[model samples]
Structures are given as structure tokens and as C-alpha cells.
Target: MSAIVNRLAPANAVVPEQQPSAVAGLRLETRIVDGAEWDRTIAGFDEVCQEQLHVFATARWPSVKQEPMLFLADGQVVGGSLMMVQPLPLRIGHIAVSKWGPMLKDSSAPHAAALRDAMVEALIADYAERRGLMLSVLPRAALETDNSAYERLLARGFKRGSELGFPSRYIVRLGLSDAEQRKSLQQKWRYHLNKSEKAGLSFEHAGPERMGEFDRLYAAMSERKQFPDHSAYDTVPLLMALDIETLRPELFFVRHAGEVVAGALIFKAGDRAVYLYGATNDTALPLRAGYFMHWQIIRWLRDNTRAGWYDLGGTDGFHGLHQFKKGMVGEAGVITPVPPVANYAARPWAYLLGNGAFWARDAAYHIRRVVTGALRPKARPDQAPVVVEAGQP
Candidate 1:
């Protein structure tokens, strides 16, 4: 799941709650649209990510409004952005969020670094530098980690957010042989995978035909656990409609005895697969169904499909969620963080609200768990589990 952070509270669904900030200074031209052309414009950029797609924006902003923003230098496109602007659930003012984007590059140009710098400078002067509205961006980790990109973003006033979630994705390279891949996993993870194998759980590619099953398991898990659910945006209908070869949403489950106990839904785009959503029955927790599902998917991506990379999703503190990924993918897997420099500082109130909302959300989670007597899952013998999502690990 994508770590969500910002949106704008539009007064009416059709127009911006805050008036559009006028463009000034420099010869940079700008255009914002809510059309099919956004997809065509961003096609084939080095920074391509699923969240940057037009259909993804549609899935995400089903209830809110979204605009695709472009920065043009002379007659050429310098930067492209997709913003999901909407109010928070409780009527607090809105916040705007941009994830793994504004594809900051010029495909047809020379000196990509120089062009990107110029485009970002204009982007800063245009959007982030102006008002104090609630705006947060989780740029490509490649951009945030590089010395030049890191320095430029900080100079523009983006404060890093959390180390977990959108800031970083846990990625495992799939170029290794099966034995090497198994070795990369933590020792215990391998043992557990073997143990789960003895349980004889079966794997099935239950795509869109099982959407309701995926939805019900997902919703149940969301309520029983504390992980954020942006799966609402990347719904079954949208995923099922996509071409299976270029991009496919896959569902794999672990069936024990005769019943389905755990499942995962992942998206394969190009040569990469990202875990989008997953579910498990609490009663079957000890069976390590989640482990089976994840391992099977990783193996499948490596052996059965063209996908050469597998993203095990993001961190959730040290909770079962993060620990599970770490155990399965091990140290060789890279964790991609959104980085603080790209989280552009929010308006003071918006900052407070964002943090407040986060704290309150966690607070409610703990309270509910206590009321429900839900014990936290033990991650391993060496550490204490982060009590965020009990069922997730």
C-alpha cells in the first residue's frame, strides 16, 4: 500500500477550494488538465510509477478531484505532476498529495540533470514556494537519495516525513537463482516457509473473478488491524480492466485443508511487481499463511513471470507488517524511503492537523486493540513487535 499524506479540501467537487496560484516570473508556461492526455505525456519517462498513471489517479480520487499539472519551459514539457486534492474524512480542510512524481525529466532532451534542475526550480517557484497550503510529495527514492536532488529539494523547503511507508518501499531484485533467493531471506523466514510448505497450502491465481473475496478479506483485515488501506483507490474493477501482459493485478492465496486462509493482491507493471493489498484470517495466523502467500508470489515473479523486481510494500514501524517483509526479503532487499526533503513543509495548521490525525489514528487503534484484547504478534525471539498491526505480520 502507498503511504498517504496530503490532499486539499475542495469546497465543491468540481473546483479548487483555494484559487489557483497565478504563474509569474521566468518564461515557464504551465497547464493543468483532468484528461487522457496526461497519460500520453508521462509515457516512457525513466521515473515511471503506477501511482503516476491517469487511471491510478482516477481510482484514488473517486470521491475527490484530481488535476494533472505540467510545467513547460519554452515549448517543451519540463515537469509533469498528478495531484490528489481532497478533504480528510472528518471535515478538516483538505491536503494535496503527489506520490512517486512529478516525473522531473525531459525525454527528448540532452543534459537530463540540468533540465531536471531547471524544471524543479520552476516547480518550486510555481507551487511549493508560493502559499502555505497543505502539500506533500513522496518523490522517487532515486531522486531523494542522490546528492544533487537531495540538496535541491531541501533548498526548496521540503521536510522529510516518516521513515516508514510512502517514503520507502521494500524492494527485492529477482535476478537471483531460486537457491540464492532463498538464502537472501532471514534464516527463520526460510524455516517458516518450509514449515508452511509442510502444511500443504495451495496457491491459486484468482484474479478479478474473486474480487469480492479480496474485498471482504481486505476490509476485515483493515478493521482488525491498523494498516492504512489505499486499496480502496486501486479497486478490483480498475485492476481487472487493465491488459494482462503489460500490467496485471494478481491474487494468490494459501488454502489450508480445504479453505482459503490467506491471500495477496499484487500488480505487475513492466518488469516489476508491487504488493497492493493482502488478507488473512486471524484463526489461521499461526499457520504462517501470509508467509506462504508472499513467498509464493516472490517465487512466481522470479520463475513464472517476466517481472524482474518485486516490491514487498512499505514499513509500518517495527510492527508485524515491516518485520515480515524484512524477514522474507532480508538485508539484500533495498528499502526506498520517500525522504523528508521531498515532503515539502505544510501550512502550520495543516502540519498540526496531519500530525494530529496520525497520532489520533494510532491512539484509536491501540484503544480498540485493548478493548478487543487483541495480542500483538511476536515477530521473532530477538525483538519486541511494534504494536501497530497485529494481524498484518
Candidate 2:
């Protein structure tokens, strides 16, 4: 018997609510992308915005055995869908999952709704025809207060699943002039920047050729702290490969005695720039290199890029990290959830078991940390200069 059978009986056993054949007075167009073309389509989309969904698809598409579809309406591309066929170890058939992600454009318009409905219908038909998937998971971006998409999904018989954690991106408006920008900073932040400058710290831009230095500084910091290993740093070759791509690496390096002491990596996409990575040398603590590096990047974005915002990505919910980001100019924005799906035969059991397992693991982790005092590590002063170099631009 399939593990799914041992888990939950097929979804068919549970009758679902009937949904309207159309929604929001719009029609959608959906098609499948297979083979090598999937990568190209994903890469093309990445040029517009580097959302995690696109990145995940790009990285895992080859192995995921998924098909991509683009939704169109009135000859304009409105949204897209990705369906993955997953075959479990003990399952007899593949489970199909369709994520309602990486929305190409605004989904609020009446036309957009029609397009979405059509796209979703096409996806369902495709799955049913392709030997039919056991279930589909769709997650939409929580771009606005309206939960129209969620309601529509519910109407179509999809159940609410686990809430996925997303980075609360901090956006700093960049239209302000230099003086205005400085004034906009929280008084303490401004004071620190000025103090760092007065303490003899200088900043410079780094490129691909200087990546080795950046890696060394990052490795040193990681060794000193209990943080997840950043894939970019662990895989230098991947970072170098990105250098050949279109990502603009605006790496700011703080220097003392003509040596790198700290650095921040800012990645530009369209009118926005994101603070992707940073590292510093322990010996350069007095100069407040990290503060200077951040300030320098903000200034650079303000003056040159004319970019609208600088994103300080990721925070541990409303914790200290979130507070630091909140201190910046823009307000916090939430990302939508990315849905997951298991086989219909396993869906019910998986839902119950997954939630229980998640809480249990979290509780154990907390207890272990509390007992070991692992959660209360003393904050280390930033010291370390990051060297910056880049490949031929």
C-alpha cells in the first residue's frame, strides 16, 4: 500500500465545495513549459524581479520535473503558474502541485481575475489529463489587505495550509538628497555614521576580483557565530558564476590602512536595490565599519541609481532584527505564502502530522537553547574589513 494510503484516504473521499466556473469576470490562458525552455523562461522572469519563488524554481526546476505556464489576457501577460510532479518513495502515482506564485502583474483588475481563473482551469485540466495529480498547492503574495485570491482558492476546494515564513523586507526611500538622507536617519544612526567617519574609516566599491577577500571575511564571521551557512558564501563558484550574469553587485568596502575592514553587498534589480550580504573583520571594530558601509550604500543608491528603495531583507519576526529594519525609512511589508502539497491520499494525515511535528520541533529547539544558554550569546562588536573585487563588467 502507498504511504499516502497509510496516511490519509484519497481527497475524493471528502466532498469539496463547488466553485463557479468563472471568477472576477475574466478569462486566463495557461500553457506548459518543459525541457530546457523552463530555465530560459525562469531566467527571463528573474530579470524583472528576483523573488524567492523564481529563484527556487530556477535552482530546482531541473530536478523537480515541473512544467511552467504563462497566463495571458487581452494579449498581455498577467500571471503564471508552476506545476511540479512529485513521486513519493512509496506512492504509486505522482502528486501534482500548482503554485499561484510570482504573479507577473497586478491581480486586482477585473481582467486579471478572468485571466487567473482561466489559468487555474487550464492547470487543473492539464493535471487531470496528465494522469491526474493527487492534489495541488497554490500560494499567492499577500500584496494587499484584500484576500480575494484566498477566498477564490477556498471556493475552488483548496484548504488553508501552513503559514510560510517570509522576510519582512525593509525599504528605504532613495529620492532624498544627501543632506535630506542624512537628516532622515534616526538620530543615533546618523550619529554613528558621522562618528565612524570621524574615526578615520573610508569606503570603496568592490568587484568580482575581490570576492576572495569577501569570502574570507564572511567565513571568519560565520566561524565565530551560530548562523545558518549562507549558500552564496559556501559556494564561491556559484557567486562567481553570478558575476557573469546581469546582477549588479554594488559592494561597498570600508577600509583602514589601505586594507578592507568591512563590506556590504547590494544587489540591484530594476528601481530597487537589496542588501544581500555583509561581513566585517573583528579588528576593525573601533571604526564602526558596518554602519559606514550601510550609510555608503544608501548614499550611493540615492545619488547614482535613482532607485526608489533599498531593501534590508529578512528579520526574525518582530524581534530586534525587525526593530532595526523598522528604524529605517520605509514601513514593513509582508510577502505572501508559498503553498505546499502532498498526495491526496496523504493530505489529511500530512496536515495533522506536519503541524504537530513543526510545533514539537520548535519546542525542543527552544528548550535545548535555553538549557545550553545558546540563545544568549554576547553580541560581538563588528571588526573585520571585507575585500571587494568583481569580474569584468
Candidate 3:
């Protein structure tokens, strides 16, 4: 397929400066629908999320049938949440999961508590009518403390789980303007950024037409890093298509010399922008193209948009990558806890078994990678493709 390329604005084109805004009110709503409806909802949500950095837009519940309940306030759709159920065999039961929201604005604890109450009430009402739903799980965004908002939910009968499954690194705030951003970075990172700039690295916005460049870079990294599954790269086309069709090209950026060498995929949900996917040529490491790419993207958002937090996604708590992201800027947010649903009713049991089977199927992915690597010879470096799909790079 021919790639879609967006023209870059002329160097002299005027780019407006960004200004910060205060928080706004909160509102809530719910929409229940089947697969088609869910898909449409997700697409719409994706557009908003890509611009806003809200987490609810990215969270997918495993279910053939789904109902998305959204939260709005002050006339703006601030949150997208849902209740999902998965079917199981032998009449055991179904699994239920609901999220309150990717609460956009930071509100007072009382206001947040009220929103949680309303969402939980809606969930209970929906759950009570369903026979197969044995247990319901809600993965809320992490908060800093045991406050009234959380306390209210627990008081309302929801129990805290022992484990936090969806723990995300907290928001890192890199100030607007390249100079200010550079000043905020640690001395060593700043040194690398300077070195990268001296190497003649530059960044550009990417679109569908240039997706091939992204794909090539991503595939090269995947092979070198020995990534366990190719699906991470496979999802590129879909995500890029989604980005373009939704008019959110700011979600993607590429760094290059005369040709693309490294890139990253970013997603904005609300006031948050997430650093999602990235890949670079190992040859570009010394130039620190990755560092330059990240620095530029963060500066753009900080200067041109209302985004407040940049999520580096997930990482091994103590890994080098995690530490690198930490050094970028911003305080860490709460770790998302994923607790098992406690209900053991037959319906729930069936759902778990079936879902577990699906999980096992996914787990086999690493083994497949191992076999594929062992059987297929590596492509010669000289024969590497010039362009690849979008998100992969």
C-alpha cells in the first residue's frame, strides 16, 4: 500500500505559543451497546484520547459484548469508561469489569468521591440484572494517598485488591520551550541531548505516507532487542490509520538525518500525553537520536498544547529504561493495582477458565518467537527495507 505523507509546515510558518488553564467541572454518562457500537465509540474515544491523554480511551476490556459509560462535566466529555463481560463454558459464569474513568481534571477529593459513587452505582445496577456476571473488577488510576475518594468506594462495598496490575509510571512534567526543557534535564541527559543536536539530528511530524520509515526502524529494533512478540509492531498500521482518520497526527514523530532513523508514537487522552512506542537504528545510538526525538515532542506539547503530563508507559520498576524515563521530568503517579475478582460463582468461574485459556494462548507467543528466530535466518543488514509501516518504527 502507498503511504500517506503530510507536508511539513515551512520553517517560517507561525506556530502559536501555548498557555496553561485551570481545572474544570466533571460530569458522567453511560452508553450500552454491542460490537459495532463499541467499535465506533472506541474510534471516537481514540481521537479525543490522542488529543487529551486520558487513560480510559486505551483500556480494553475482554468481551464480545460491551457497554461504555462515559463521564462528562462542564459540558465537555471528560472521561470514557465501560463495563465488560466475558462468556465462559459449562455455565460457570461471566467476568465483569468496569472503570470509573480516566478522570481528566484533578478535582478535590469530595468531587472525585461523588463521581466514583455515581459510576459504581451505575455498575451495580447493570451487574444486578445480569445472571452470568459473578464478579466485577474496576481498575482505577492510581492516587497518591488513601483519601476520601478511595475510601468512599471501599465504603460502598468495593474491596481493595492485594495486587496492583496496571501500575503506570506517574506524570513527568517537562516545561515548555527547548531551552527550559534542556535546563530541567539532569546534567548527563542534557549532555547527551547536546551531543545529539551537534550530530545534526532533526525531528519531523509523520503521517501515513511515511509509515514505511517507521515500520523499518521498528522492525530493526524488534529484531535486535529480541522482542517476545511481533504484535507490538503489527498494531502499527491499525494505530496509524486510526491516528490519521481521526486527525491526530501529533501522536507521531520521527527523527532523522536526511532519512528517518528513529521515531516514537505518542497518545493524548486529556491533559496527559503518553510516550507509547519508539524504535531507533542501533547505529543512531551514539548520536542519541532517541533522546532528541523525545525532547522535541515534549517541547511541542508543552509549548503548543494544554497537555500536563507525559506518560512513559510501563516498565520494569527497577529497569534502566524506567530510570531513563524518570530522569526525563515529572513526578510518578500512583501504580495501578489489578486485583482478581473475588466472586467464585459458577458463572464467574467459567469466565475465568475461558479467559485463562485465552491468556495461555497469548503466553505461547514467546515460544513462537523462539521457534521463528531459530528457523529463519536474519535478513542481511545491507538488504534492510528502506520503509516500513507506521507504528512499528
Candidate 4:
């Protein structure tokens, strides 16, 4: 962690000086990155989220570790990814998770897919060599809706998809007017927001200093809600550790009668803002603090964050949280879960376990999807097969 890293090019420079590869026209190098190196790698990439940044990956938390990686084409940083490593019960190796990334400096290149494949291949090989046997990844892509990355994973022989896993998703694209946004929401949602606005609720924003407030309310909210004990670490510490002045979190609190009633915490990286976590008290519920918090959060992203999208994060199968997130949409877009990709390490134990379990997982998920698709009606007249949208990263 103390090693000095080689710096990449300037922020404004987009092109990488290229040369021939050993494999003819294919030319890219993938390398594991350390602290400073990871910083530079992410800085060079075009899109990212706080979760994909190195600080979030390398948080000092129980059962979590980070492996930052980068892809280079002709010696210029072109792609970056963060793998969250956690030990698998009954297994000797770690399970690596890459969420929302392997972001490229430019995913719009003429030969982007080819470059992506080559770069990903190198990354997979590196993971097998240095880390564990199984890598579980959900590209920072929209599930069900976009599948370009999904197809690419299949091409590389990685098993994909999930059943009863990977939460359903919702997202809001910023830059829309307040009225236009409200018009997009479900009827009841719009009513809630309008009601919440007149309910005498005020908003407050904060950073890490207010984490304790977040923690206390979150605990009370969890107890009241009775969610499964969080199986993961609190992300506040991760965000706290980062040099995130530019991408600082906007922690919004709903105050009524000068009392903190509800809260939402949003995180950013590159140009994306994700509603990381939030909680509401019973008092805040009738006041519709959640609705007001989201509205204020969206406005903050549009103005202060310089971000383009607001990821409402995931929704439970339970209708309560799902309905609340849907209300926030106004007219914003939604993103479903992206398919998960699995690549095994070549080691004997890794190969045997990965080959058997990974393929089986993929088969089960695929079968379920096929059955559901058949039962569901088509969105368009000529739609036939399960086709993925083209050109997404």
C-alpha cells in the first residue's frame, strides 16, 4: 500500500498511444493495481460509482477486501475495475465481486467489444493467477434491459444470470424539470410527494461527520423494519476513507418541527449518483419523508454533484420498499440487474469447483428466465427472442 505508483496521462487526454500486440491486432495489458495506481486507473476511466472506487473496495471492515485492477492498451490506462473479495465458507479461496465496472476510458471505440474481450480475458487470467478460483461479477450494467456485456461474458465462456439473487433495480436520469419528473411517477407516488412537500418537512445534507446520526437511525429503522441482519459491512466507513471531496456523499435528512425524522445517503463516482442507503421512522412514514428525501436528493445531484444518473439502488421482493423507490422515479429511467459472470481460476481445486457450480448456477437461472419469458407478454409487436440491447458497455 505504501508503494509509489506510475501516473497515467492527464484528465483531458482521451487517446492512448497504441502499438502492435503479440496476438496480431489485439493489443492490451491487464495488471493488478495498488493504492495510488488504482486512483490513477479510475481517474482515467470515463464512468464509475463510489462502490467501484479503490477506497470503497479496500475498506477496513470485517470479511471484506479489495483487489483493484486496470487494463492498458499501448501503455495508457484504458480500463479499470474493483473486485470485492470475501472468503467463501468451506472453500480455501476468496470469492471476488466486481460491481458496476471494468469501466473503460472510452467504451465507444470502433473496436470496443474486441478490446473489451481481450482486456477482460487478461483480467480473468490475472484473477485466477493472483486471487481465487471463482470470480462473481455483475458488470455495472442494467440487468434484463441491456445485455451487451452479458453476451460478451458468454463469448468468454463465463456462466451468467441469477435467480432469487441480485435485487431488482431502479434509476433516475437527471436534468428533467420538477413537473416533468413528477408526471412520470405512479399516481399515488406523485400525490405522496406533493403532500410531503406541504407537510412542513425541511432538508439537511452532510458527509462523514453525520455518519453516527445515520448509524443510529439506521439501527432503529432496521429494528422497526426487521430486515435480515445486514450480511454486509456498513458502506459509510468505506466512503469515509476516500478522498471524495469532488464525489462527496450527500446525506439528506428530513426535519419537521426541527427534529430529524428520516434520512437518505447518496454516493457518487465519476458522473453517477447512487442512493446508497436510507431509513424512515414511523413518525416520518405518514409525513412521507422518504418521498421528500428522494426529491431533494435528485435536485442536489442535478445541481451540486454534476452527475447524470441517480441509482435508487435495489429493491426487495417485498412491495413496501419497491413502491417507495418507484415513487421516486417521477419520469426517471430504471435499470434492472445485469447478469453475473463467473470465471474460474485454472488451479485444480478452482477449476473443479468453478466448472461444476458455476455452470449449474447459470443453467438454473437461464431455465427460469426462459419459462418466465414464455409466460409474459411481449413489449413490442415483432419481439421474439431474449435479445440484448446492442452497444452498451
Best by TM-score: 4
Query: RMSD in angstroms, all models?
Result: 9.0, 9.7, 12.8, 8.0
lDDT of 1 at 100: 62
Instruction: Give the per-residue Cα lDDT of candidate 1 at 117.
Output: 46
The worst-scoring run of ten residues by lDDT in candidate 3 lies at 13-22
Model 1: lDDT equals: 0.60
Tell me the TM-score of model 1: 0.66
The TM-scores, one per candidate, come to 0.66, 0.65, 0.66, 0.76
| lDDT tens digits by residue: candidate 2, 1-393 | 111111111223111224343444344444454523433444333223433233444464444565555555555555555666665434544556655442444533554444444555555445543354555554433334444555565666555544434323456767777787776676666676788888777888777788778878877887776454424443333434452243435667888878788877776644556677788887666776767777788877777764566767655333555545545542222322223322222345543443444355557755654554454453321223211111100
Model 3 lDDT tens row, 189-210: 6777778888887778766787
* Regions of model 3 farther than 4 Å from truth: 1-29, 33-63, 71-79, 89-91, 99-112, 128-132, 138-140, 143-151, 162-170, 174-180, 230-233, 243-256, 330-393
**Best prediction by lDDT:** 4
Instruction: Give the better candidate number (2 or 3) by TM-score.
Output: 3
Rank candidates by lDDT, best first. 4, 1, 2, 3
- Span of 10 residues, lowest total lDDT, candidate 1: 9-18
> All models: lDDT?
0.60, 0.52, 0.49, 0.63
Poorly placed runs, candidate 1 (over 4 Å): 1-33, 39-46, 62-64, 70-79, 85-97, 104-115, 128-135, 142-148, 156-168, 219-234, 242-248, 270-272, 303-308, 341-393
- Total clashing pairs for each candidate: 14, 24, 34, 5
Q: After superposition, how far is residue 111 of candidate 3 from its true place, in Å?
A: 3.0
